[model samples]
Structures are given as structure tokens and as C-alpha cells.
Target: MPHPDLLFPPDREVRAIARELFALTRDLPLICPHGHVDPALIADDAPFGDPARLFVVPDHYVTRMLLSQGIPPAELGVPSVDGTTVQADGRKIWHLLAANWHLFRGTPSRLWLEQTFADVFGVETPLSPDTADDVYDLLSERLAEPAYRPRALFTRFGIETLATTESPLDDLSAHARLAAEGWGGPGGRVITTFRPDDVVDLEWAGWAERVERLGEVAGADTSTFTGYLTALRSRREAFIAAGATSSDHGHPTAATADLGPEGAAAVFERGLHGTATAADAESFRAHMILEFARMSIEDGLVMQLHPGSVRNHNRWLHATHGRDVGGDIPQATDYVRGLEPLLSRHGNDPRLRVVVYTLDETTFSREIAPLAGGYASVYIGAPWWFLDSPDGLRRFREAVTDTAGFYNTAGFVDDTRAFCSIPVRHAIARRVDAAHCARLVAEHRLDADEAAETVVDLAYRLPRRIFRLDRSAA
Candidate 1:
């Protein structure tokens, strides 16, 4: 269970001040401008099924840690794409988690799950092999309650706004279903974000087929570069019509380009015919990042770039289970050089809103902060992915606060597929930000009144303003 003063500074004076700051934002409705929770979870409004499927199967944080301890994926209920039968017993998976609960010590996953078990389900007993069955039965009983249904939990969670990401190839039937039921609009809670990674990456499996379907869905030709851009623009409009205020991109690097018309067309044609070399694929992806920036200026979707991830690094798992079951590693990012083309063109445009997230911590002070500090258009993304831990958030503030300051940053994004972890993650950010502010106050650098406002802005408002979620429906 989380103590009342959890994560507070040990210094008595600063700890008191930190409590003051956290209180200002503790109950503010969450603004989840970017995340991976499936909208169908709420649109369907179904039971969460069981504790294993809810906490262990879909949560990579738990699975990744257990995998590091030499546990097979089959024991954790991970379904394989290669038709391998995996464990289907919920009680057994929960027992495995209990048997290895000690592995989570000092990880953000431990903090999240402990608080989730306490606050969400009112389970305060320490999880252990001896107590596993009792805890499992208690969780099973609570999950069977109507109060624990996904939609009921959303309302109970006080999520004022939530955004789920989808590729351009997605018809967004779930979002459409929610919108028709009065769930997404000017004051609605659930919305979609337009993610074009599937159609943009020329080397992705089934890329050509997805591009053809993109044209079909948008009612435009995709044979030529111009037609392809038109189809992309059409999809952006569809996303906007469905209440998307932002577009997301995940590339291997922060590279951007100005390939001009002919170069892009040649690459597009080569890609269509499956003759594009690796260089052709890389350069075309770089060009699309910049193209999307230009499109953001025209069409009003905030552009979010997540770069420097060599996704699916665990080859055997991906070969059998498909992508997103962990194994994305960060590499060094060259933001200064990679983004020059886009920044040189649109960095001064106030109409352009670009939030860049890096898996590389070195880029925080060296590249990203300076870029956000200089450009009116660019904003620093919050600590994300593997770096969203308590120390990681503190490190982010320590590194970037001097260069970019608070307002130039786009605050916290849960960026999670684990829906129940949203409030806990935000609580972690709040506690860390309060601690950061309390440190400044202890050193007499910032006033307490100002820290109060800063905590609220970081906790709730900055994402709303940056993602244009506060704007009325377009």
C-alpha cells in the first residue's frame, strides 16, 4: 500500500512543502493526450475478465520483468502468433506472479501494482506465495462487480480526456461507436490519434497491402507521390472528424528530409514495385516526417514524434508472437542534425505544434531541450517509455529545466497500454514534480505559490493546451 507521504523528500521542511504542492493536483481529472489503451475497452464496456489477463497478460512491464528472470512467455498467458498453445489458467498465472513478486522490487511496476491493488481493489495484504490464493479470490470477487467494468472504471478514474492511437489503415469503428454514443466530442472523454507508421514504413510487413487499403478507405489514388499525399491528407481529415487533435509517428531515428517532388515520387514508385533498397526506404521515411510537419501546419493536428527505438529487438519472440510484446531498445539520437530540415523550414511557425519524445536521455539536455528552447514550434516531451520511472522523471527535470523550462515542455503522457496504471503513473509524476518543486523551494529559488501552480500545470493542464484538446471540435 502507498503511504500518505510516499516519495516525499526526507527533509522535514521540504517534505512539508512537497505535500502542499501535491495536494493542489492530487484529484485533478487526468488529461491523457497520448496513450495506447484500446478504445474498445471502453466502447464495449465489458468485464476485465480476470486478474491474470488484466494485470499480467497485457502488461509488458510485468511480462518483461518476469521474462528477464527466465520465465517462459507461455507461463504468463502470452498468446503466440505461431499457433503455440500457451497457459490459459488465470489462477496459475497469478501464482507465478506471486512466486516471483520479489523481482519487481525497486521498479516502477512494483509501485504501480501495489497502489493499484490497494486503491483500485482495496487489497492491502502484501502479495506472497502463502497469500496468493486469498488475494486472487479477493481480486476475482471485485472484478466480478459492475463497479469494476472498464467504462465504469473510466468514469470512476475521473479521466476527463483519453486518447488512443490507431494507424491510418484503421477504420476507427470503435471510436465511431463511442462518438455515436456521445463519448467523444467537444466535452467528451474518448478520442483517437492518427498514427501513420504502418503505411509510412516501406519495410513493414504488408506495407504495400496497407497502403492500397489506405487509398480505398480515403477514396483517393495512391499510385503516385501526389496521390499518396492526398490519401494521407484524407485520412488526417477522417481522424480530425473523429476528434483526433494529434498525429503520432514512431520512427527508428529523428531524421527528417526535404526530398522535393521527384525524389519522393521515385521512392514511392520503387516501394510500390518492391524494388526500393534500404537507402530508398530510410530516405522516404525521413521525408515523410517533414511532410507530416507541413501537413500539421495546414490541417491543425499536433504532430508527436517518438524516435530512436529499434523496435522488436528480441527477434525470436517477434517471429513467434508479433510486435509490441516488449523488446524495444533505445539508441543514440542526433536531433541537432536529424531535425534540421524540418526545423529550418517550420521551426518559427507558431501555427506548427510539434512534440518530440526521445528514448535517448543524452538528447534531453544536449539536443531536445536546446531545440525546444530555440524553436517556437517545438516542445519537449515528458520522460517516456523505459524512462518514465521516478528517478527518470527527476532526471528529466534536472537536465531540461535549465534549458527549456516548464512551459516549453508538453508535460506528462501515460503512454501505456495498461489502462489501470494511468492514475498511478500520473500520481508518480505528480509526486516527482512536487519533489522537484520542493527542492527548488528548499533552495529558495522558487516561491511556494508558484510551485503550486506549476504542479497543477504539469499534472493536468499542459497536455490539454499542447494537444489542442481544449479547443472546440473542428
Candidate 2:
């Protein structure tokens, strides 16, 4: 039997109203402005290998929860960093995930998985230990169909554009291929986002080598600080040519430092020698952030900063498994003090687009909203990472709406690795936003028509505008 709460918007009258509002915008093409999905997947346009990789391993939301329950990641088919096989049998992993599905009972992962199963694969039976084989077989069968290929699924999902993050060392060959083939010329678009985490942080492993490679790619000397910055600039241009419209930064904090050129050069010199103190490294990073903002003003690329994750908190897990396997945790972060330098420099600039995201909910009302509300260039990103659930999304809207209003925020970005869950995530976001809007209408704060329009804006229009996709060549 289907779950009683399966039908969203729970109240009949509210559900009817929400459904009516959803109908107006539910089919609007998706604008995935920011995500971590591999650009190569879209470039290759290959069929996914199996259900385990599709549903279990790539989804940190699913795997990390399972890991918390003492489930070994290897048993769930998570590949090792060295590319060794972990689990070859998909059925066993599916059964394990099914048996322990209760771990996600109250979580958004449960909601998304259920929606994916029902809406995408046409599965009506609930997933459980007994039904694991049945569900896996059904998904596998669907995967075999031509309609389920990456590009085909992108079209079916109504994704007008999807921006995938890429490291600085990357050649953007996949994005180049997509553009060369004109895949994004007419019906679909896949663009790259310049992610320079590996190159920016002097603390990162292989930073020196990655810096050299960045210089090599850009035909710069890279032995000096000026050469390094120039190489990054050139790479940004290259990414732009391949359809990129944004740059993403995953900093540990929202700190930004606007040091003068001499001060910045001193810090960069320390970084180059691998002898920089922690303070010097941080200052260099901050100075580079200011530089990135200046570059944004010049290049017309949006700047997205996702800060506050204490990445790889679990050293044992990181050693055994590596980063981004659900071991990262959030810490309280300060944005006001951290961002003061950058804001003082470029806050009034209309051409520079800086979207700030946080795992620290405390900042929404007190800091983020107020800053974004006032600044021409600043905007708050949607609920992200650990907070992308229903309750989290609701709190975000409630906390910021009074201060920032709707327009100061960028709409939803799925920020997911699980390709099949894209539509599922977007559907949940839309429904939640509509339900919130419905409450506003019920209270007479907003007319029904305005609420309806806001639903469409939140779902489709805001993301396009904030990500600057409408200006993109289609």
C-alpha cells in the first residue's frame, strides 16, 4: 500500500490550492544554476552503469546516512580512491539499503527517493528488504531504455541549462565537446563552472603541482604570483568560451581580505615557497577572493561562495574513503565581519554578482538578508548542503523573507551528484515554496494570483536571472 503522506500538500483544500498554483509553473524548464554533477557525464552522453552507482554511491545524502548506521561504504559499492572495485553485486547493496531504509524515515532523502521511484520509474510498491530486487530490476530496466540516457533525461527533465562545477586544473574538454557538438545550441545546455579550490588553497595536497598545471594550461610561467593569477584569468576566459557563466568557491569561511598589491604580493610570495604561515595563506586566499570579485566585474561571470563546511571532519573516513563521502559537518560561521572587506570594495558595484551561501542558519535574518538586501551585487543562495530539506527550506524562507524579501535571494540549486534525483529535488522545492506561498494567501498578506506568480518565479525565473542564464546563447 502507498504511504498516506505520499500525496504532498497534505490538507485537501490547501493541496487543491497548491496543486492549482503548481500547474502554472510545474512544467517550466529547470534552470540548474549550480551543481557538482560531472560535466563529463553530459559530454560522454553515456548510459549509467547500474542501480547501485546511480542511487547509492554517488548520493552522499543516501550513503552518509547509511554510513552512520555502521554500514560499510565499500559494501554499498563505493569505489576506492585508487579505482579498485568494492562491491560487484548490485542486488546485495540494494537489499542492504532497503532493510535500513528506516534511517531516512523523517529525512528529505526518503521523500526524494520515494518521488524518484514513483514518478520517474513508475514504481508503486514501497521499497523494502523484500522489494529490493523488484525495485532494482525495475530501475535497471529503465536505465536500459534510450529515453533514460543522460542527454535524453536532461531533455525529459525540462532542464533548460545545467552548470557543472569543474576544477581549475581541468581542461574543460567535456564542456568544449558539448559546445562543439552544439548540444547546448538548440534544445539543451550544459556549461562549466570555474572551481579553483585546488589551486587557491596553499594547504591542499598537490597544490604546487596543480598550480604548475594551471600555468601550463594557460601558457603562463606560473613560477611567480602574477603569472599564477594571469593563468587563472586566462582559464576563466577559456571556460567562458565553453559556455561557463559563473565561478564557484568552496572556502572554509566567508573571509575576504582586500590587501593592497604590495601586501598581496608578499603573501603570494610566501605561498609560492610553501613556507607561508597559516595567516599568510589565509590572507592570500582572501586577497584572491577580492581579485575574483574584480574579475567578475570585468568578465560578467557570477561569483558563488559556499562557505562554513568544516570539510573532512572525519579524518579516519577521509583516509579510508576520501572527501565528500558524508563525513563533512557544518560549523557556526560569521559572514558580516568576514565579508566586510570585499563588500566595502565592491558592494555597490552592479556589474559584480556575488551570491553567498551558508550552513549557518543564524546569519539568514541577522546578517545575510540585511547585507544582500542593501548591496547591489550581493544575493543569498538557497538552502544548501545539509539544509536542503523541507524543514530547512521552510526556516530559510521564514527567516529571510521579512528582511530580504524574495528578490534578494537566488532560487534553488539542487547541488546534487545523483542525476536521477534532479527532478525529485526540484519537485520538493517547488511544492514547499508553494505551500509557503499558500499560507501567505490564506492570511491575506498576498493575493492568490501574486502567490501563484511567486511560485513560478521561485521555481523557474529567479534561478535563470540570478545565474544569468537568460543572457546565455541558446
Give candidate 2 misplaced runs (Cα > 4 Å): 1-13, 82-85, 185-188, 472-474
The number of the candidate with the highest lDDT is 1
Q: Please, what are the lDDT tens digits per residue for candidate 2 over residues 54-140?
A: 888777888888888898788898877777678878888888899999899989898888888787777777888888888899989
Q: Candidate 1 overall Cα lDDT vs. reference?
A: 0.91
Candidate 2 clashing pairs, residues 3+ apart or interchain: none
Which lDDT tens digits does candidate 1 get at residues 45-84?
Answer: 9888789999999888888889888997888999998878
In candidate 1, position 279 carries an lDDT of: 88
CA displacement after TM-score superposition, residue 324 of candidate 2 (Å)? 1.6
> How accurate locally, in lDDT, is each candidate?
0.91, 0.84
Q: Listing every candidate in turn, what is its Cα RMSD in Å to the true structure after a full C-alpha superposition?
A: 1.3, 2.2
Candidate 1 has its poorest 10 consecutive residues by lDDT at 465-474
Q: Which candidate is the best by TM-score?
A: 1
